[model samples]
Target chain A: MLSKTIKTILTISAVTFFLSACSTTSTPDSATGSSTDGSSGTSGSSATTDGSGKNSVNDGVVAPTATVFYFDFDSSVLRTDSRALLDAHAAALKASPRSVRLEGHADERGTREYNIALGERRAQAVRAYLVSRGVTSPIEVVSYGEESPAVDASNEYAWQQNRRVEIK
Target chain B: MKKVMKFSIQVIVASFLFVSALSHAELTISITKGVDNPIVIGIVPFNYTGGGPLSENVAAIVSDDLERSGQFGPIAPENMLSYPSLPQDVVFRDWRLLGSEYLVIGDISPTASGYQLVYSLFDVVSQKTILFNQPIVVARDGLRDMAHHVSDKVYEAITGIRGAFSTEIIYVEHQKKARNYRLMRADMDGARPKVLVTSKQPLLSPSWSPDGQSVAYVSFESGRPAIYIQNLATGQREKMTNFKGLNSAPSWSPDGKKLALVLSKDGNPEIYTLDIATKRFTRVTKHFGIDTEPRWTADGKGIIFTSNRGGKPQIYSVVLADGYPQRLTFEGDYNARAQLTPDGKSIIMVHRRNKVFHIATQELATGTVRILTTETDLDESPSIAPNGASLIYATKRNGKGILASVSLDAGSKFALPSTSGDVREPSWSPYF
Candidate 1:
């Protein structure tokens, strides 16, 4: 009887941990006015409200923030304006031991696979820059390939806003 | 004045007959709800100038390609009234009388070192030139390739979708005699298949770069399926993303810089992206459940992939930035191996509903869905042509895997029962 009770408790603990790891809260974009910064989240703006409404903000850990790097149309090359942002990310990552993920993106204009590769190149360029800056804490990179949009509007201005790499 | 007026009237009548003939040449492809009707098209022999018998027959190949789509019924050359080489040469009355809805006319002229092909397509009802393509040339043995170029144009202009004819499809032709799997690259019509690399071991997942110059596929030569990218020009190959556990389903990023592949190197089957230039990899999905068959959206902002995370194999999209994933499909119990249309507005995926696997297209914007294929048994791994008008997928016929294509808009569909062996993993190359 005792052993069975202990096994039940252990299984419950493991399940809770697994659930926490995959936990995501989807809040209305209208309610949360905070936009992704491309590196880490600013406290209490949007990432604060958990979708379930129970323990809206993560209790122990801070929400991940991001610093964004923007690009031109049909291009993966880092623009002149993105250099400063990339530099800041490199410095922040250097100061911390936490690993970073650079997400590459593109405006929805070209074919899907081409956009994927372009987004990858954009993230890789950011990763290479960070490595060059001596931040070596496992900078993982992936290309969203125009799947997610930072801005909801579909015009050129919004698309330009969408074509970016967010470091988190 | 009377003689001149008579000649002008004759010329106009001849021109009218020619225009009508051009219109009548088109094969009216009616794809009404996918019962497998191959589009019948006529590729008349092109008139050649200054040629010492051009080595390759460009028109015949185009006709063969259309026929092989199993969705196209190529008009017999013997039935053509006259081989109209140019627009003014066609007799509309004759072709309209013969019941051809679409007609393609092309000619080859000698260039400095090669040859140039100019082609046009006419819709029978419109009686106007519907499609016109710029001239393309090839030197010596390359005229065959120019034929493919013309095929692409005609296929696109008529269908409002890009044509995969100019693109090469790499598939594993399973030969029963030797029990060997041959990795072959064939013209989109399944002709002139040249074995690039073959193995006794099973070869799967042949993928093409956006540039169409290279192919990345999984080869089991090393006991396990390993990803390899082969350049078409020099036949130079580089072994990419071979890790422990499962390494399969290699898909290319649109820019040709990274590969979205399924690897168990980190633990279970999860999606990973490998940079071609840097040889670096980043894990995309962190699911304990199976996450495989990753494909990119046109804009490269996110990837739509197959994951059993929701209890069944369903399509999901993940933003690469922080691995934020959103479920894209919920209608079917099993949906795997999705390919996007050229416009990226819809995803054609294999959906399993009521224990039958069918090819279905879902509008990403409206969430309105319709099944494009209702094949009785398993129909999997659909790849859209570059033009997005039609799709070619693998299905089973006579217990052997064959290729089939269907026009999504026209509802025209056809099957290509392989004369050789079972063909699998058909990936349409990017438009040339």
Candidate 2:
């Protein structure tokens, strides 16, 4: 009975000690994560969401955002303005372990299967950019093809709105 | 086996009619456009020898079918001088004077088992019976189908081509709720509809089994795309594939033993064939560019698929012997969702011209691409009729997606007029 009591006391002490060490390490990491993400997110929202999107075109000062990214018709190349946002998202992910899901969509123009593949390529392009920037978060990608459009009309504005990748 | 009684008695009909009685909506067909020279036809009202109720007007349905094809103009009931029930009574001179090049007459008789339909086709100008008395018997519930068969026979006899009237169609319609879809099957004329499957996600690319007993479609019900094959008669379905990535664009082989579909499980969209019985897979495409929408050749020797490897989407065929895909379409910047014509000498695909997508057919021999539709902003999913006489496709009209059909040789156009929401993905079933 005495040995059992001692063993239980030893186990509890060990658990408490390890938990304290873990919290000590996690506090700094979480602080760094929040600081980085807050700054990056602030800059991204300010640059991309602002109506003065034209000013950032030639300066290479803009970055892509996690909210939405647009691609050219039948093309998957990342735009110049998206680079900053991609880097910001990657930096934020590196600071923390939060995962993300990227949903790819396309306009209702081309063959549905082909559009699905196109949407996939667009998502992958964004994913590749983030990974190249050294992000380690678990990012899941899905292509909805032309099935789920952001706008359900047959116009250029609607098509442009439909062709997008939603980072969640 | 219940008998339906027709009530011409005024008092009984007036009494039972309340709040427009329960009704099953049959899709109405509207021939939005007409052909240059339509053959004039006279369809006399059918004589009924049975004492049961005729649920549908057989002769009138035949006339509607002829009129909707845009190849014939049926004489109106008021314009007909006389109504004939059999070929013996059809005076060819009378029809000739009425400017009808063709005359059709039929009678329905009840047998011990069910009903028998006897029909005849007469050539008014030649003053001869083109088709002798043909007999088709069916169950009480099969009267509409039997009438459609009669229409097929009459169409073939007059037009010198096999008719597609006795076929079915499978399509996907977006339900009232967003992202909800229903996969439905109905007659070619949009009669007798049956919903095969419903999903909260998207459903697309439905292909038919060679025997018309089952269908294969792609469903996103699992929050991811997968291929499923469902048996129509048994209501039994099998999840054919659910890989880590996309499993879509299921097309059955001509022999029904295998299915060719697109799967992105291998990191990118590519053409893969799954053997239904053995559960073996064979990869048909290996390319950095997207290769999808694979369809089997008529001879089953190879597959034709859409590929963007050449900077734009085009049709390419890869035979099993060579294992190398050769480009099949070069006439347009976009030609995808290609299906082979019955003869294997032509390919029908949705083509874009002047930024408007249209249904176009390409003769592989001459490499000639002819655009077939001109009305819709985005015409897609071109499925050829089994007889290869016409095709049905999904097209946008007035901000709504609906179905339209067009002839191959003639520029005749018609629509399956619906009164509801979006209807797309019209797949012409193999003849039953």
Point to the candidate with the largest DockQ: 2
Give the C-alpha miss distance for residue B365 in model 1, angstroms.
2.6
Instruction: List model 1 lDDT by residue over A13-51, tens digit each.
Output: 334333333423233232223244322232222432221
User: How high a TM-score does candidate 1 get?
Assistant: 0.61
Q: TM-scores, in order shown?
A: 0.61, 0.85
DockQ (Cα-based) for each candidate = 0.01, 0.43
lDDT of 2 by residue, A1-168 (tens): 235433443445334323322332222223222122222242535434322233433434334343666666888776444444554455555545478888888999977888888888888877876665566788888889899886677877667667777777
User: What interface-residue Cα RMSD does candidate 1 give after superposition?
Assistant: 13.5
| lDDT (10s digit) by residue, model 2, range B335-416 | 9999999988899998987777889999999999998887665888889998888899988778777888888874577777
Worst lDDT run of 10 residues, candidate 2 chain B, spans: B2-11
- Residue B131 lDDT (model 1): 68
Worst 10 residues of 1 chain A by lDDT: A48-57
In the range B1-432, model 1's lDDT, one tens digit per residue, is 011222222322232233223321112111223223444456677889873776666776676555444344556666678898888887766666555667888888988888888888887545777866467878866876887777767766765655667776777777767777877777665656778887777677788789989988877686555789999878999888667545677888878788899776664567888888988888898976667889987877678888767776678888787698888888977677777777888889888778677888999898777887775356777888776767777766666667777767634565655666877667887777
